[model samples]
Structure formats: C-alpha cells, structure tokens
Target: FSPIQRVNYKIEETRVGRLTNYDKLILEVWTDGTMTPKEATVSAAKTLVSYFNQIVSPKKVEKKEVKEEADVIGPMGKLSVEEIGLPTRVANALVKAGYETVEELAKAKKEDLVKVRNLGEKSIKIITVALVEKGVKFGE
Candidate 1:
C-alpha cells in the first residue's frame, strides 16, 4: 500500500512532427511519508503502460515459467549478499568475487574472501555476524 497523498494532471495541445492536434498529459504526483513521489509516478506509469499494451495486443500474453533461484541454489543460498546487511562495498566485492548468494559466502574460506578486492578483516567480521544472525555459519 503506497500511500499517495495527492495527484494532479494537466493536458496541453502539442505537436508531434506533422500531428499538430495531439494532446499531451503532464502528471504531478505527491506521496505521503510511505513512498517517494518518483516511485509512485513510475509505478503508475508502468501500470498504465501494461494496460495499454494488453489493449493493443488483445490476445492473452503467455507467461514463461521462470525457475526460482531457490531451486538452483539451496533455500538459504538464494538469499542475496545484500540481504545479510553487508555494506554495499563489501557486498559488491563478494558479488564480484562470485559470492552473490549467502550459501556461496558461507562455503567460502576466510582466506579466499580476504583475497577479494575491498574486503578485509572488518568486512569479514561484519559478514560473519550477519550470517550468524541468519542461522548460517561463515566458512566451511
């Protein structure tokens, strides 16, 4: 529930190339403390675009079945490094070093992680604490 506080719109006659009678809509949206105005506007725009797309296509769109990350990795392994509350720098380093998931990080040796760029003892300690809080052990 994104609490939008206010919404305003204005229509103006505009020209698009040779089309001089085209109407352009300008929307101004405001939100409560719950969500940012930009977020609300983007969400509304996406919803409208989707509806327009469906209207134009008419035919029902077939949704492809996407495999869940948990299926490829273990359940806990599907958790992203960022989800463990690691700092952006530390998480980026781990992800760059092919430790994107909690399972991969949990299985990595401290020495191996230390070899990764931008990671050190402090980062490792932070990662360890976060993993332990999630009932996971750092390192094999």
Candidate 2:
C-alpha cells in the first residue's frame, strides 16, 4: 500500500529493485543518501522493502472524543492552571485581589497590589519584578 504521508527519508547506501503489491516493480532505490526514482539492486531493494514493511503499519483510529455543545480554543483549555505550575500563594493572592489573568496582573499598579489583603511592600515589589521579567508592565 502507498504511504498516506510520504515519509521523508535519505538513503545511506546503494539498493536494488523488487516486485511490490499490484504486481508493480520497484527499481533501483538509493540506500546510502536520499530518496530517488532509480530502482535499487535486487538484494538491496529487498532489504529496504523489508525494512519499510516492518516500520510502516496501517493507521488505526484513536479513542473517540464525545461531541460537546461548546468548543475550547488552543492549548490553554486543554490543561488546568495548576498544570502550568503557578505558585499557590501567588494564585491565592491574585484571586483575592480579583486579578485572575496574567494580563490583569501585568496591568496592575503598586497601589493596586497594596490594596489587596495580606499583601505588603515587599510582596508588591517581588510581584512587580516578576511581572516585568515576563514582559508585563505595571506603571508604563
């Protein structure tokens, strides 16, 4: 059977020709360098054919996903926020301050962070620095 996706391969040595399915003949195949139209030698071609047979398998259907009424976009929806390794304290602080997104945090000012419960000058400075390092601006 023909490959559904043409495998990109380079021949590293010389090869030969052989008969394939549908009684069609495969000829001089390049073994040492790259893919070529020329048929390979009989033995080399047989070896390549065998290798190809062993490596390639018929495609199979993976587990089916149940259709849903809603659609999610991008990698963000696939993984939970916890999977992204945000610190619990930081997340809690953000949630308490009503800042649930990176954009919101980036746009926050020093005074805004100070207004949040349990937050102080040191925490604000640290958060500001971290946000700036991530290319987010607070006072800009």
Candidate 3:
C-alpha cells in the first residue's frame, strides 16, 4: 500500500498586467502513519525535478506558430471564458454552468446564469461587460 492517503490541488490564474498572466498551484497531500507529509512532499518534488532535468536542455528552442481556436469555431463565440480574461473564480463558475465558450454564454439568459452556483449580480455584470467587449450580448 502507498503511504499517501490523499492528495488535492487547486490552480489559480492571476493576471499580472494587460498581457501577462501567472498560475498559482496549491497542493495538499495526506499521508498514513508510515510517512510524514513533509517527507512525502520532498520526495515527490525531488522526483519531479529529476524528470524535468532530464527533459530540459541548455539549448535555445524555436517558437512555433500556434493556431487560435477562434479560427475554427468562428470569431468571438468560439473564444473560451478563460481567454476573455475574467477572474479565475468567475471563469470557473461559468464553465461549471456549461458555458465554456463565449457563444454559449451569449445565448444564455441572465436569469438562468444568475442561478449558477457562486454567481450573482456582480458576476453577471462582469460577464456582460466581457461579452460586450467581444461584440456579443446575452440573451434576454
């Protein structure tokens, strides 16, 4: 049996500026009586570092042309809620309510969106503003 009893993680996206974003990862690990949580965490970290060291090199890498989903899904509607740059909590709430894309959200009624968990008038207003900025509007 493994010494780890449970593991949990949460990822938060924070915007540093207009174009820069950073992700904060929070990890919680539980262990049985056999090993201390600190020891287990240290071991995991060392293992990850070893793997990363093996894959990474000192040479410079070339950047590739990445395609945007908007090209395939249309224009603004295809854009993801995260891409719209809403707060992490708001974006997660919207996605949880089955509104993953801007187009899907635009077609949803304000009353229905308000019923989603953790969403209220302020979140609705934020969504409205974001959609408007993208040249879209919510359904009546």
Candidate 4:
C-alpha cells in the first residue's frame, strides 16, 4: 500500500451531553484529477453544561484563536514520525521518554532505548543503523 499523497484532518465536538465526552473528526484525502474524498467519524458528545446539570463542577473553556494563517510552516503531529521512517510504536516510545524531534533521535544513547519497553537488542540495532545512515549519532 502507498502512503497518502495529501490529506487533512480535524477534530470537532459531536453531541451535547452530560457526563460523557464525544469527538467528531473529519478526514479528507486527495487523489488524482483534483478529486478529494472526505469522511467524518463521530463519537458520543458531552458538554460542560451537561455536567453542570448533573451538579458536577464544569471545566471552563478558554477562548483562544486557533485558526491557521495562510503561510503556516512545518509539519504537525505525527507527520514528523512519518518523515523519520520509524515504526509508530518506536517513535511514540521515544517521544514519551523525552525525545522531542528527529534531531534528538541522533544523539540518543543505548540506555535511552533500554528505558523503553520492547526495545531490546534487535530493535536497538535496527534503530541505531537507521539513525547512522541519516547522519544522526549518539551524543553528536
């Protein structure tokens, strides 16, 4: 299977309810001839008002401008993981253990991988070689 040529995704609230949180997400994938396929996944929605109705303390939603400007730079979220060509599980383990970005992966030592579960000898060797090819070295 090939990777997606282009895609966009967003998360939204689905339903207004109490004591439950639901999420709705929209994903759009692009194909040839300028064609775009869109899909929406919905989850059960919950609102702070519903919590207040049930006499539970409701959390506040602070107002903030979240819109992206026309000239936003750099990738977001899991895109970095894809660019590095590492397994998702490995990338997540690295990130969770305080590895922020690809540059950090180069300088990661053996002990770092040891700290992550399931990153035994074989996995460490594979990752190390891959990083070396990318000119990433431990303590570099």
Q: How would you order the candidates by TM-score, starting with the best?
A: 3, 1, 4, 2
How many residue pairs clash (N, CA or C atoms closer than 3 angstroms) in each of the candidate models, in the order given?
A: 0, 22, 0, 1
Task: List TM-score per model, in order.
Answer: 0.46, 0.37, 0.47, 0.37
Residue range 1-140, candidate 2, lDDT tens digits: 22122324443443345523333333333344332333334444688888888669644769879643113222232433223345677667767777766555655667777888877777667666665554445544
**In candidate 2, residue 91 scores what lDDT?**
62
User: How many pairs of residues collide in model 2?
Assistant: 22
List model 1 lDDT by residue over 1-140, tens digit each: 65897888999999999989899999888778787888888888899999999888887779979866444444667788988788999999998999988877877899998899999999999998998888776676
Sliding window of 10 residues with minimal summed lDDT for model 2: 68-77
Candidate 4 structure quality by residue, lDDT tens digits, 10-116: 99877766734788878766645433342211111245446666676556779988654211222322234336677777777676777656555554668767877
User: For candidate 4, what is the lDDT?
Assistant: 0.57
Cα-based lDDT for every prediction = 0.84, 0.54, 0.84, 0.57
RMSD (Cα, Å) of model 2: 13.9
Which scores higher on lDDT, 1 or 4?
1
- The sequence of per-residue lDDT tens digits that candidate 3 reaches over residues 1-140 is 78999999999986767744788888888998798988999998999988888778544678977755344235887789999979999999989989998878877899899899999999899988987877775655
